[model samples]
Target: GIKISDSHDEPELEFFDRVPTVWDDTKVIHGEVGKYITVARRTGSAWFIGTITNDEERKLNIPLDFLTEGQSYLAHIYYDDPNVPTRTKVGIKNIPVTNKSTLEAVLPASGGQAVWLEAQKKFVHPGILHTQADIKRTHKLIDNKTEPAYGSFLLLKEHKCSQPDYRMEGPFRIISRDGEYRHTKSKMEADFSAVYQNALMWTLTGNKAHARKSLEILTAYADSLTMIPETNDAPLLVGLEGLKIIYALEILKYTYPGIKDEDLVPVNRMFTEIFMPVMENFYAARPYTNGNWGSIVTKTYMAAGIYFNNRAMYNKGMDFYLHGHDNGSILHYISGETGQIQESGRDQSHCMLGIGAMATLCEIAWKQGDDLYSALSNRLMKGYEYVAQYNLGYDVLFSVWEDVTGKYCDWKTISDKARGNYMPVFEIAYNHYVRRQGLQMPYTLQVLEKIRPEGFDRDQPAFGSLLFND
Candidate 1:
């Protein structure tokens, strides 16, 4: 079969020059022995697929779902054809596609087809949790007074917008030697979360006040914060706590002219100069902290990375997220295939924090063409299932495990405290792994169904019913 005389080799030989020999990912896609088989492989961002059939001619539909969602790709397909001008009898065509597309896979008897999918431009902002398309979908749903999202919007609309008095003497130094400034820290977090929620409301409703409040709080932080967060309970408490505001800024900076790049100078300084050093010291010094801490810290980097367009910062966060040895890395956070988390023995509520953080982490990474959600054989999904199953009054497999801090150990059973309370965490996870990926998550679906249109859970983006569910 290696025989190729002059003027006989097909264009595939030329195409081979552009294809990589090694692949970053691979999927079986479709196949059957003695009948037909189709496989797809990805080298970097580009994907290549090959299909062949037996003696019988057959047809198959290959879904391009393996491609990153919301991203565009150019697909060049080469298939066996009966009416081709060349000796090889092959036809070639190029078309644009996304994760939403499917291809008509027609194979002649004993023939084959091959395709190459090349990546194209990304969304306006990368690493964002939600895109313009996502907001647009939510807008349409809300306008039509759709069930879940609209009902969720009405529930959210019942709350009054925050009028943060940023002009006060200062949001000065955040401090906690043992327990001091804990209340101040809580108040600060609530204010920023408010700022973020307001900005989100503005995006969904085009409310001027919501947008203005977000900007005003950010401007105040840029001008007022005297020193970085310093605390004894700080690693778990504060490190420039504004995870939500970062997303809010992501929405406003591009579409709204009210906040200018120059206005963000002080704001960026607030993150890099004021917040970054403290955050670096925390994870660097306390790699042995709880998984939830790692989750939030990694999330901070995700926000900063997207906001400043610092791929290095983004990648740095990703490095710890994937390979870090601490309890926070998804590999270590969720144990084995059982999805049992580190804090399972300690308390159910704390376990929810880790799961929520990962949901947001995976969402941000997924939009960036990084599928962290599916990491470790869907380990994060398993973690959610483990927690949700337990919270829904079901027994789960749990083993004695020690945390990174070594403070809580020798626990033999899962803690039953707060077992029945379902947090606002399952919506995004259910929507992604279950609805989008078509995976069955009975416990997760039950939990989400119990709390449809989940509202604010805590210091993170909590309005999944309004922002995530379709």
Candidate 2:
């Protein structure tokens, strides 16, 4: 007979779900030839034990000596029960345990016991952009009528009603050289903006209508669109355009229970079959083509990996983010000495785009326990400061290389349009550096204040005030 039950209701299965990886301190505590075996492993201050027996039944003594010295834990034990009159026959009990405690497990013939020992304390939720706790905290803040959070919530409520309507179906294709292609691309961008804004609004407001609308838009495209047509600017389309939708899906899937598992299947398949391959190849093959390409694409890859819960994909994206192939990595674009970005020679628009993308990436990474913001002795902050100084109309002394030769040449001057359209890029950086880290970001703060109540617009970088200000 096989043990059959909902995986969600099983202790061992739940333990595996929570602790995806086991610790290196795993060891075989006791074993007997053809009789029984017992093994224990630790993960994130918790210990899990599994014991198995042959046809012969045996009683085993389990010790809690491996626990942290000063901490206590609640040990959840699951074992086979012959009297339960079910094939699964699993029964569970909770026992308080300490480093000095010992437990006895009674194993039946062809049966085993599983123990999950967890510390009774607050634990941090894991993720890149938003954690479970962060979502709960956002809810609490809104409920408490907090200032910026409530303001952002009210703004999203108004924005959802007044936002432009988007089509359900799309012949979504990329033909960068054609005017029609750009129009379609812009339309798709507008659609994603609606999707993400609505999904996030649903999270804040608990309105089922908003979630349903977001799902309606998502399912329409996922069911109809097979692939995004390739073009000269495939990387940009996949990275910038496709990634925004991915972000919406991430928020929806995690925040709302109304989203069915079946709904996600097709969407995940679309990502794996179409977007994943393109992103993998783009980052590996075209890392040096343009600085913005790597920044945007790496952000997409990292966020997609987190959405799908794929560690390999996440690590691959992180690797490309830190170390690019030729001249496309963050380190490659950011100057270690002056901290000016590589695209600064081109224009401030692309410079802000690149900086904003990298800043968002660092924000997500910081949430996931990686400090790419301060990597390379605060290289990203330096890049932000350099760009902010110039964009704020401050004169900056820097040299630009026109070609591979070390020849210094004057490129396009920073235009009024570039300086005026400051994307909501400073909120995340200012919040992290100034409010959280207690570090000074004078220029970043000035720009952030200038763009107070930084609302959304039809642009590559949207949802800044909604995400970061709160």
Candidate 3:
């Protein structure tokens, strides 16, 4: 008896080389006897057929009835060829085939043949979009005559009307002030926020002027800006500021066709060389602070990954989010037990900031085929409810970490700053949970109703109501 593995020069390898195998679609078409086996598989629009015989050399007629009727295909056959001088003796032939065609297969002892059938058609490149299709759907909704969508579009139009004539000046850099960078950080943030506003205006209104102005700002910064100095707020600067700039660029690229390749080359380099490295290094050096830093840093990394189309960098961002530094992992920050965020003990301002950034990251990931919104079994919603309840002036009992005991031993209480300054973060979450998914978020709904037509404000990653409300 001849062993199938004993054949040193197997011609069957040519089949796999010529035809891509889709394991998911593989089926054993004929294998009643152990002496012979036949298999068929479909990949994309093509099909692969393979047949093998044990010991006995055999002749078999194979039918092509499995193919789609009325369609023509090209069949590439790889058959054993003992007459060939090569060790792996295989002969190839290309023949026209159809559903009505049948072909004879002759096999040597312990030999096999492979056939690849492909349809004749034009090829097209499947380019990746910067944002998800859902985002595109939302953009269409903006034009619909509805409550939130209409109001959101009008708010963006108002923002466009408020902008001045475009100006470009940079190679901009600022160092930490008195061991802090809050003032300089705010300045950088506002600049990028303007870019997002302009890009968004172009997207909604189809106004060429808005597109041109946005490109002007982006080109200026991408050309002149070399580095952002590492300051006390470097993490926030790189993550938060970089995220907003990425949003602006994504919108600009999506809306405008006239942006030159030269303009974007420098901008891409800036992200890869400067902003990305800063974010990665910061997260590596200081992992998990049980606060907003991890989320902010991850948000930047994810944005950079999407902008550059780098899967490794994108996965790195997801890793940081799923398993962050001690006390800082998104899972740990939002208590599984009580559904409250870790930073609620510190203040409402920071807590909201963290929640806002996390939601933005989730939105981005959701667009890219990741369900991060439900990663921790809806822990994000719990965190939102935990904050929204207090911000809406409702008292809820919960536990928080006490610095003295180093454990969650104190009763939760609203801070003096609680609900005082509303951040434009509610729209994104509200749209996803309440509007899109139809999940009830009463407190969150109340917050959204109060802040309808959300506009850009300092420190908010997304344009909020303007971009996400619908």
Candidate 4:
């Protein structure tokens, strides 16, 4: 019989949920008499593979030649992971595979690996981050005011009734020398924050008042902010705050039938007419400021694209996210799987900011049936681990990385400013990799442990414990 219980937590139990009790056929994929053996078994519509090794550890490339050619499978993998804090020391995760796919399994001394490949199926209804199911689950957990979530709910409680910050003051001709137009920008952030907090309250609690207040804030902005001139900071302004407005409106539009298409007339007009020109212009300019700049722009545009059913906009965001020339693209941002991000040598705050910002985009993309989180062999996961390990007071290998602007840290080391003070960034990443994807995120979990019951963030995503803890 399998071991009864362990402290491995989420990944441990999730492995049990999919282990097949019976199979149709079995075949040896590879073997070395007393040293190790790898076997594959087929069930009704799925395939499972198990491999074990003697006391000596080994690295093996297991070719999935047995799978039907030209067909796709979602492989749930369980393997030995010393970092997994459990008696069994097993790790688990999911990855897409085909007959031509090859899995690289790293086995420890007397350790093994397992994989369960099943045919692809339809996914859940795509929403920003909190889908209908996600919202329902959050509400169910809130009924008891669950520990960490309870903590987060209490925090949200303080701001759920935030008065809408519509810039009723005239002379709204905003100007910024170098993103320093704080007065109007602060109001913009506050107004969007009100919408988000109120929408979140309505989601967790069955309070129509909260919903109305959220919509009221959005409608107010629609009425007042007519023209968004391409002030120097217009792109930066929308890139940063548009996500909040889009996320809030998504909740309201899905939950409240009161929102008519015409109600969005002014909002859509403003975004398309003036907002889009500058945002698109920013990417076209290829300023290559930092990973966060392009990343935030990609996120805002993607959110708007999916929300408005604008495929061109969605394509643009996805294009930039995957292969933009800027530092924010997946390839450019991650720096060749060392998990050293594009902004690693810059400073800890900016490094974590870029990480969390990209994590936000990946989360959104994941819900929509794309797997950017696990793309490039879990490159984002590696980045999370690298950042967490450094911030948790450990030394990591560093290499000279230069940006498009030919800039490098002359000190030849990662910046130490605000090192240990972690942002509420890792919780979403931890939940996605460990809980949803069944992969071990040891360092990310550590960060979350240090800062559990994650607080809220005004611009970037926060409230991780409440929003993502499963």
Candidate 5:
């Protein structure tokens, strides 16, 4: 028999309804195309979930209150994306999983996953709070009794570019030789920034070996500067320059803390000679007439330039994002001599990029005790409220202006768009800002808290508004 249960004559499960908590089993184990999965979900009265795969390993933070109030319950998980059906889709097997549960989940190569929760009678507290300050903090935070958004962004920990030939791999695959032609060539057009971003996460976590490997590929790209083409149509597949280069330089400085000023001169030379001119032309020519294209690239470069204290380049780059267009102006890529301004994901994403970059710059400035930088930072933070309106769903905010209708919708309706889509990152970031002033309560609660018409928790409200100001 190909597969069977271990029994004397018939198939039977060895551990029926036995909840297994494996917090130690953290790393991903399997990698299969469209069908690999592994997760370590927390099991306690309050649920915690962690999911990852061979392709990408991401962290998740879930609050304990996503469960039934004052009741100990169990979770029945069915974790596989049904849309991606294959012969090896994990079969559904009902098991006794509970809130005080930290379950391990493993996913395959190219496939995705899903996790479900159902109430079962089982109560166990996970000793989450202890000290007086901790208790006070918790009480103050939840006095309004709102739930937190349980989402994660694939943040980079650290990346080092010492050796000159390390390249990273991509997640997608082609079925045949001809099919490969239509797809982006992973090697030829690899996105170095994304690789750096992912590597940064490793570095932040003190994974020195992983950080070195990621940086190796980046150094290789910098060494072969002449070979890498100047202009590439592939948006995701371009070499880092200007502000990105400055970011890389900052990393190098961090890695080699005791290096002399003369040693830094050579690294600075590469930016001034090779990258600076390109930035000047790119900013001056301004090829992208409409859309967020120019702003996104410009802001990335400007952020880096600002870090190096390149006043002229930094100002121009900042201007492109802050004042190039009026608020709510959209970028339109139409058939014309100039790019038209139409609401698009390109602009929305760039808008976030602009605001986020400014925030980081302002923080750096404030730390250095520079009043000018502090002023600029404050201005950017105030301006960000206008763009924060665009965060749409869980991990997938609406990039197109049309999706939001250029005005606030009802909170329930906003919750509808935020349901189960891959937009959790934006929600978390936007909430952080809004929550500071105690205004994140209603909007966040609208999504995490289920609405009931007649005391039935099962009846969730659909199409609710997320526009509660306070």
Candidate 6:
């Protein structure tokens, strides 16, 4: 049973003999973008109580008729109380509810209320029963070591602001600095997505201090992007990467349970109002070379669709990848001249970005209720596997490279030194690690874990002997 009330709100679904049999058993209350949503789901039925606030305080009167009225109702209310150890700790109260019953809840200066309702059997009042089941279940799903760590990794740690000297010399830097971008464009714009991904991780780890700091960084960067040039030489590249950061802000809130409303406000604004329009223009103009760069365009738009909950955009993005685009796969590079479909071709960063696009699209497909998208993602994984099983040598290096001259090439012979640094092991270990079905060390994970002593495990043959030298 679920009952939530807000002032000037009407119950959408009429309560009847129907009992909420499917409860999510998980309750997450946090600000999503500029709003706070308190959700309590049991089995399959979910009671989503949400409030949107800006920089000011407001009052909301939530109603109780959303729950079955004929039966006894018990509401466990958790508001942002000023005087409490855990600010959101709940209080239970027994109440008889009818179709017209309503409850008044006071919201904070910039916060609001969230409630969980448990309905009891008509014969035996549910108000009297207090069980630790829901908390336990929430803990079970959320407290897992990997889930929190994964969120932390994706949200916060992955984008550590160290800004190594090596990264400054990359193509991305060239695009940012010398690509004829407007003076308003900055490197922070490129780093935004990475920043919020870190913030989400920080929120999940219960590292409140670090989480808050991450949010501050994210907010500041987002705020700085308020001004950007409308036209640029590399608009497609910059716009897509910029949109990625904006989109990350949306996914981060859902990935972590404790994200505050204040942290999400600025991020939400940029994504909903600012970035959406830019993306629409990009898609409409077919900005990236006759849309042959579908891989990058599709991935960027897919993130846009999922983050904004725009099913049409999501479907169109997926369609672009699957059928609309010239190439079967969604990823292709834009040539500076003649808008031909070019590829870096099995290079380290190129392959990883390719796989990353597939991984992201698969996640979106899962969310959009399309099983075929799921299958395409699998096919992509298989495509990566084709490189691993037959086309791999020692050190997880590629067996063959598809050079532009139509001649087979070797990984060691790649011209770009920075990309060449990781090519050998990348095509091999990275794929295996992502799938978690084989024993190989991912170069990126290993690189991030570099400063630690256990960074290189000598015991594992694949990691120790083939790749790293002790």
lDDT of 3 by residue, 318-401 (tens): 656654433455656787656677777667888889989888888778666666676555778878887888888887665655
lDDT of 5 at 457: 9
Q: Which one wins by TM-score: 3 or 4?
A: 4
Candidate 6, run of 10 with poorest lDDT: 122-131
**Cα RMSD (angstroms) for every candidate in the order listed:** 13.9, 15.5, 14.5, 11.4, 28.3, 19.7
TM-scores for all predictions: 0.72, 0.68, 0.67, 0.70, 0.39, 0.44
C-alpha lDDT values of all predictions: 0.74, 0.68, 0.67, 0.74, 0.34, 0.40
Which residue ranges in model 1 land beyond 4 Å of their true spot? 1-127, 161-170, 173-178, 237-240
lDDT preference between candidates 3 and 6, better one: 3
Candidate 2 off by > 4 Å: 1-128, 140-151, 160-180, 286-288, 402-417, 457-461
Model 2 C-alpha lDDT per residue in residues 1-470, reported as the tens digit of each score: 34444322322344445464648678788898788888988777778889999998789898778788888676777788654322345665566678899999898888898888877542223354667676677788778867655665666667643243535435353323224456566566566667777766776677777778777776766776665555657777777756666777887776778888898887778777777777777755633365777777778888777777654566566656654443446656777777777777777887788888888778767776766776666777888888888888887766663321223235644344566568767777777777678888888777776776566655444445546643
Worst 10 residues of 4 by lDDT: 162-171
TM-score of 6: 0.44
CA displacement after TM-score superposition, residue 243 of candidate 3 (Å): 1.3
Clashes of each: 0, 0, 3, 1, 63, 26
- Taking all chains together, the TM-score of candidate 2 against the true structure is 0.68
Candidate 3 wrong stretches, greater than 4 Å = 1-142, 160-164, 167-171, 175-183, 288-290, 402-414
Stretches off by above 4 angstroms in model 5 are 1-185, 188-195, 227-245, 255-270, 325-341, 345-432, 435-470
lDDT of 4 at 422: 86
Residues 3-120, model 1: lDDT tens digits: 5454333444434655787889889998888899999999988999989999999999999988998777767788887775457767766677889999988888899898988786
Root-mean-square deviation of candidate 5: 28.3
lDDT of 1: 0.74
- Sequence-dependent TM-score of model 5: 0.39
